[model samples]
Each structure stands twice: as structure tokens, then as C-alpha cells.
Target: MTITPAQVRSALLARREIAIIDVRDEAPFAAAHPLFAAQIPLARIAVEAPWRLPRKDVTIAVYDDGEGLAGQAVAQLRELGFTRVEELEGGLGGWRAAGYELFEDVNSYSKAFGELVEHRRGTPSLPAGDVQALIDEKADIAILDARRFEEYATMSIPTGRSVPGAELVLRAPVAAPDPDTTIIVNCAGRTRSIIGAQSLINAGLPNRVFALRNGTIGWTLAGQHLEHGRQESIEVGDGVDEARARAREVAYRAGVRRIDAGQLADLEAESHRTLYRFDVRQPDVYAAGHLSGFRNAPGGQLVQETDHFAPVRGARIVLADDLGPRADMTASWLAQLGWDVLVLEGGFDGDLATGSDGAPPPRGPEGRYKRPYEGTDNPAAAMQAYLDWEYGLVAQLERDGTHGFFVI
Candidate 1:
């Protein structure tokens, strides 16, 4: 079957259940995809699609940028038991030709919306050079690596502490006890950094806050040094514990549940029930060493994209995080979105496998992803033009009246 862009747009506008799959590589998909599309590269269809889109008969539409990949993907999906699979008419190029907005960057629309927030509200920011210099000087800066603990341990600015995304609100006061100290948040790329910084800002903190400019990718691109195997002691205080408890209550309000490791094991043992477990950390962290069966789905995008993360619509989901904030925060969003989401108990605290530390060495450069927004030879003008379009997205979100997003 073939689905037109207009029909897809209408389905999106009506809030219908349509899995708009972009069967392009990570790069182009990140460069641009339809506003509501989720990426499942054609190469990964046989392995990823069934788990991602578990409902065999759901309305699934696939697209590629005029390269005929979508047609190929539809055939593969059908063979894989996707009973209602269809290709997007004209593919991604057709959708673009229909004049619908295409979002860019990883979780592009959300990050673009965040940039728009910064543009409009002057969301605080710190330059990578300045933050790096402060770290070098050992100044009173609390560098919060907001991706996840494992991501922090994988490679981080020398002075960074692993503060996974959800824990910012709960751990902030303790991590930056000196009200005079500057607090900076970072992630592999942008979304978590923006959301983490804004989270602290919204909580009315006494300390100054800023997002690490462009996150870890920005730090790497700026020719900064990253440290690995540097472990720091973290102490959760009474105040922080109380804050975390309060955050849990907030999550309960949002519909999050807590389950122990044993229950998770029991659930995973059920062969008939499909369970999706996400470490809810950065990709680097997942590579470093995560729950044996869990995949990488960084907290911010996971919550922003519940449907893509757990396409079964009603599948049981277990999230793991050493720091509680991210799991609670993400589970809260999932519950509100009507998913059966729970945060797993117990943190992963073993040593590195490759190192004497007993932790497995992080997956190397081979595992690092090249974002779609970047181009090997694409001109500077196109990049700038792309940013200009992304810059106007928040206002468009308001006009379109979709997203169902509210600043927390």
C-alpha cells in the first residue's frame, strides 16, 4: 500500500496512531525528517522494526529521501510480519515537496524547540572554551554531565560529575552546595543539556545555571580533552534524598511505578510478553556497560518519544539509572502518556571489565554516531539555512497545536 503525504499529515494532525518510519541512515534522518517521523534505518529493519513497532497490524508507513529505500523497506517489513506496512508516497522527498516541516539534529524538533526557548527566553548558556578553562583551573564550577553516569565515565570533561538527566532537580542542591558556584549541564549532544539546564532553572535554584554549549559533541569539536576511568565519589545527602523523594511523588503523580531487579528478571523471563528495557543513558554509557539486555535511549528523547521507544502501546517497560532522577522523570512522562512504565531498583555499581576497575571499556570511536545534521560536503549556507528553519520551530509548534509539550 502507498500513503500520501497529505494523508500522513492529516493523520498526524488528528493525533492518530501512525508509525511514520524514516528508512534512511542515521545521518540523513538527523539532517531532516517529517515532523512526526521516527527513524528506523533500512539496514536495521529486520532487527529493529519488530521490537520498535511490535503491533503487527498498526498503520506503519515507511519513507526515504527519493532513493527508493522506502519501497524496499516496506517489502522487508511485510516479510517480517508487519501486516499493515505501507510506503510513503514519494518517500521523504514527497513529504518535503508537500511543504511540511522537516526537523533536523538528533531528536531534531525537540532540540530545535529548545534552541527556540533559548532564543526567546534567553535560556542560559556557557561556552565550551570557558567551561573547559574553568575545569582546567579547577574553579568553583560544578560540571554536570547530564547524559548518564556511564556516559560520564566513558568520556567527559575532566571535572565533570555524572548527573544523569532526570536527577538534576533532585541532585542539584547537593552537587552544587555552594550557592555561588556555577552549574553547567551537558549531554552527548544538545537535548538533554537544554532540558537539564532548564529543569534547574525552573526549580528556582539559588545557583547560576547554564547548558554546556552544544553538549559533549560541542566539547569534542572544540578540541577539548576528555578523561576516561576517572571515578569520583558521590554522596547523596538528606536534602537531596528528600528532593528525590519529592521527585518520586511527582512521578507518581505522573504515573510511574517502581519495581525491583527480581521482578524485572521475572518479567524478562516471560518469552511471550515482549518487554523493552532501556538504560536511559547516553549511547556511550550503554557501550561502556549497561544492563545486559537494555538498549540506549537517553532519558530526554525517550520521554519526548514514548511511542517510538515502546511501540507496543501497552508493553511493560523497565528503565535503569544509577542516579534516580532520570528514571523517575522519564517514567513520569511515560505514565502521563499512558504507558506501563517503571523505573528499576538498584544501581549498576560493578567495576570495568577492560580496566582493573572491572568495568568494560567503552565502545570506541567505531561506536560513536555521526549526527544527521552534519554534512561531509554540504555547504555552510545550507547548514545556516537549516538552523534558520529550525529556529522558527517553537512558534510553529504553537501554531500547529501538536507536540502536547509543556515546559515543566
Candidate 2:
């Protein structure tokens, strides 16, 4: 069986459930592919398929850029009991021939949605030099690094504390208790910074918030220095009551639903539908205890890498958290990005699982695009080019025309 590129676009535009699988190694898959193309390498198909593509009857379209791996992938899926499996008509070339854009980099759709959010919302931001001057003057401000703690510790703005994505709403109040204190959100690049700041603003935090524009890349290009070995992370504070109210309001605005255990069970029993259960909390917290069958997707990173976490674009996503607001805040963004998302209500105290999840199947560095912001030692030219590419994502998203994203 074969599915055409036009049909794929129609499905995405209509917000219909579809998994457009790219059965290439991560490196080559990252080089260029459709915005929603998910990399589930041919070697890992037997293992990853059951987990990522849980619904055997859900539509699955496999494609490759003339490498001829699509046929093998479809064959494997059929053997694995996937009833609706097919190759993309003509594969990746067919998409380009149909005049659809092949976006570069991993998590391409999530990155594009972030750009669209900023474009639609006019999310406020501060350039690296100005933010530096503010820090140098010892201004009444809190610099919240929205990247993971590991990334923040690797290299971050001087004195900035680690506050990953979903933690922005839950932790921002404690980190910047003074309503007058300026709150600066930044990541290694543009998307997280924008999404982090916007999340806070949408949550109605009283403090003035702005994304550190272009994030660490902007800092590097501006000749500003970044600090190393910073170990600070914001604590989950006593602001749960307020955070819950605010986060719920934001989620409501984005049309996210609240689902009880029974509702979730009904969802799980639907063999024809795909459902993803994710515990959106810090890794350590999730490892300590979380509802069974739910994978850990730290809230902020979940939004930053939604396509990776849930490859089926229209799959139902249930986000769980013991604490109040993390799941709600994460759900809000997912809903806005055209996802059918829900927050699992009060499941933390139930029978829970412990221990960290093993890493995903590794795809070696072959054709991967080395993101300029990952390490501290990238050449200046590479860093600038990455930012330039991001600046054009909004335009690309417009041209793609299948992203049903709306920013609140």
C-alpha cells in the first residue's frame, strides 16, 4: 500500500491521527525531512515500534529520501501486526516534488510551532548584550535557564539558575519572589527561550518576563561570556495553590481537558487509537515514583521535543504529575500545538513505578546536522547559521500550511 504526500498533508491539516515514519538513521533523518517525519530507524523498528506506535490499526506511512528503506519498514510493520502500514508515495522525493518543504534539524515541527507562537504572540525578548548589562549592574532580576539542568551546568549565563520548561510556572515564583524582579528565560537556542517566557506570561506571572533572544548562541555571537559549572536549580516552592490556579486557567484557555483515571483507562483500551502517557516531572522526581505505564518527559523538554516524545501527530496525550501545575502547563502548550492533550488527575499516590528509563536506540553520527548550541566549542559561523535558520522557520511554517497551531 502507498499513501501520497497530499493525503499526508490533508491528514495533518485536518488534525487527523497519522504517524509519518522516516526509517533512516537519526543523523540522515535530521538533515532534511518533512516537518512531522519521525525517525524510527529500520534497525530499531522491531523494538521501538510497539512502544512508539502502540495502535496497530492506526495509519502509518514510511518514507526515505530515495534510500529505499520504506519498503522494508512497511514489511516489518506488517509482520509486527500493524494493520495499516504503507510507504509514502514516492517517499521523501515525492514530498518535495509535491512542493512541500523538507525541514532541517531534529524536532523540526516543535521548533516550527515555537516560531509560530512567537510570530503570533509577539513574545517579548531581550538580546544577550542588554541582558548582560542588566546582570553586571546587579539589577533586581532572576535569570532562569530553561534548558535542562545538565545543559545549564555545562555553560550558562553568569548567575542564571536552571529552570527547565514546565518548571518555569511552578518554580518562577520562588526564584523571583519579588513581583518587581525582572525574570529572564533562556535556552541554548531560540525555541525554548521563547516558549519558556511565553509559558510564564500565559500563566499570568506578575514579574516582567522576556526570553534571552537567540539564547546561548546570541550570547556567543555578541562577544558576551557564558559561565561554566553553575549548579543552581530552582526549588519547587510553597506557591502550589497559586501556581495550580494560574496553570489551570492557561490550560483552560488552550482547551486542554482534565481526565480522571476511568477516562484514561477507556482511552488505553481503545486498540484503534494511539494514546501516550507521559509523566511530566523532573527525571529524579519521576524516577522516585510515577504512575505505571507512563514514560518520563520532563515538562519543558516535552514541549521542546513533542514530536520525539509522541510521534503520532494526532495521538491523545495524557500528562501526569504529582505536583500541581507541571502537567497542566505542559498540556496547555500541547493543546495549542494542535494536540489532543489531557492532564491526568490525582494519580501520583496510586500504584507507582520507580527507576529511570533506558536510553533510546542509538543512531550513530553519520549525516546528523551538528547543532551549533550543543557544546561550548562550536565555530562562530555555525552558531550564527543555526539562528539564521530559526529566524526563517515562521515563514516555512506558513508555507507548509498544515500546522494547526494557535498561540494564546
Candidate 3:
């Protein structure tokens, strides 16, 4: 069974559900792939396929450059009960011959959409040196690290607190109570930083906000010091009601819809369309208790890694939160990134699930991509290359016309 690259492109252009899986390890797939291709290495196809491909009936196009893995992958998937599995005809060469866009690095479109957002909005930012200067002078500033808590604990900018993405609007006002205080957001690389800072500005916060330019990569390249092993602490300011209101307004401006529990049940009943339900909150809070059937996807990382979480691009996403603002804020970004997203406004009061989802089985170090923005040890050349890739994404997105991103 096989599907042509043209067919895959048509499906994508029509906004239909399709899973284009690169049946190679992450490292090779990261080197180059179609804009929406998700990596599900041949070796772990069974394990990841069940998790990634929520519906066995959805169309699946497995491909490989020349590794001879696609046939086996198709077999494994069929044995696992996937009913509509097939190989991408001619594999990588097929996509290339068809003249479709190919993107490098992981989370390609999400990162590209971030670049597009910054490009269109002229999202404000500051260099690491300047941010360090503010810290030295004891300037009124609050730095928020928008990456995962584990990433922040590994390394962070001086005086930066782990505030993750979705928490920015919820916690920024609390972190910087004085309107005159500055709020600077940083992530491992540019995407989250830009999205985080812009989240505040979009919500119309009183404090001045800026993304840390090039994020931690630029911070290190500039010879600035980084702190490590700090515990995550975020200030809970006095205005939960105000923050909720601001987040709701932002989502509304971005065209995100709100749904109550009954509406969500209706969405769930639609088996023809894939629906992803996520609790966009911190892991700790989620482990304590989240609405039944909702997976924990902290708002910040969910936006940063939408491709990994939901590979079926046109699939609908419903974000759940007992707290008011997190779902709205997360939905705002997802909507802007061209996702069909909604906030669950009335589901938290029901029976809740407790404990972690348990960490996924690690693929280990064998075939992982060496992401430039991760860790503190990447070479200067790799870091610059990563930033250069990001710089050119706006043009790449333009070339790939399938992206539906819109900036507000």
C-alpha cells in the first residue's frame, strides 16, 4: 500500500487529517523532512504509534529516505491494528521531486510559526548583555524562563525565574507588581521567548516586556554567565481575577472559542475528527487532579511542541483548565499558530484523575538529534547555525504556503 507525495500535499492543503511519519531516527529526520512530518523511528514504531496515532483509522503515510524501513513500518503498524496505513511513495525523494517544502530541526512548523509571529508583530526583544546590565544596575526587572522546569533547572540567565509559557500571563502581574518594572522572557532558544514575551504584551500588561534575544544560546555566545540547579518558584500575585480577564480577552482577540463540558462531550462524540484533550497546567497541579481524560501538557511546552503532541495537523484541540486563564492563553497561541483550538471553560469541577501519566519510555541517546538550544555545551558554530535557521524561517514559511499562521 502506498500514497503519493502529491496526495499527502493535497490532504494537507485541504486541512484533512493525515499522519506523515518519517520512519527514521530523530537525528536523520531532523536533518530534513516535509513541514508536517512526524518522526516515528522504525524501531519504536509500535510503542510510539499507539501514543502518537490516536485513531487507527486515520490515514498514515510512512516514509524513509533509503533506509528500507517503510515496508517494515507499515507491517508493524498493521499488526498493531492501524487500518489505513501505507508508505509515502518514493519516500523523501518523492517529496523532493514533487517540490514540496522541507524543514530542518525538530518542531519545524511550530518554530517557523513563531518566527512568522515575531516577523509580523516586530516582537520586541533585548540582547543578553543588555539584560545582564539591567541586573547589575539593580533595575526594576523580572526575567521569566519559558522552557520546561527541568530545562530551567539545568541552566538559566541570572535572576531568571522558571515561569513557563502559559504561566506568563497568569503570573507576570504578580511577579512584577509595579507597572514600571520590566518583564523579560527567555527560553532555550527563540520560539518560546518570543511567544512568552508577546503573550504578556498581547494581554495588555502594564509592565514593559521583551524577549531575550536568541534566548540562552545568545546569552552564552555573549560570554554571559548562567545559573543552575535553582528550584522553580513563581510569585502568585493578587489579581487572579484580573489575569483571568486579560487572558480571556487575548484568546477572544485571537479567535479561540470557549466550550463548556457539554460542548466538549459533543466534540468527543465526533469520531470522524481527531480531538486532543489536554490540561494545560503545570505537571504538579495536574498530578494532584485534572479533569478525567485530559492529558497534562503545560501550556508553554504544548505550544512549543504542538507537532509532537498532535501530529495530525488539522485535528481539533481542546485545552482544559480548572483555573481560568491557562486554557485561554494556551488556546490563543494555538489558534494563532493555525490550530483549531478551544478553551474548556466548565469541566474542572467534575471527578478528577490523579498522579502522573508516567514518563514515556526513553528512546535513549542512540539516535536523538543534537538540538542546538539544549544543554550548555553545544559548540558556537552549532548555536549560530540554529539561530540562522530560525532567522530564515519566515522566508521558508512563505515558500511553504500551507501554513495558516496569522499574527494579531
Candidate 3 residue spans exceeding 4 A from truth: none
lDDT of 3 by residue, 114-136 (tens): 89889989999999889999999
Write out the backbone clash pairs for model 3: none
Worst 10 residues of 1 by lDDT: 352-361
Q: Candidate 1's error at 45, in angstroms?
A: 1.1
- lDDT by residue (tens digit), candidate 1, 1-408: 799988887766555667788877766776777766777767678877866765577778888888778888999988988777878888877877887776665555556556555665577888789998887788888988776565567677777887767667767788898999999988665557776787676556778999986665566666677777657524556675656665676677666778987889888777545577877755555567666666667777675455456654345778887767667777765564445678898748664222121222332333234542232233444544554555577777665444554333
lDDT of 2 by residue, 161-200 (tens): 9999998898999999999999999999999999999999
Q: Clashing pairs in model 2? A: 165-300, 166-300
What lDDT does each candidate get? 0.68, 0.89, 0.89
- TM-score per prediction, in order, is 0.69, 0.96, 0.98
Candidate that would win on TM-score? 3
**Shift of residue 90 alpha carbon in model 2, Å:** 1.1
Off by over 4 Å in 2: 357-367
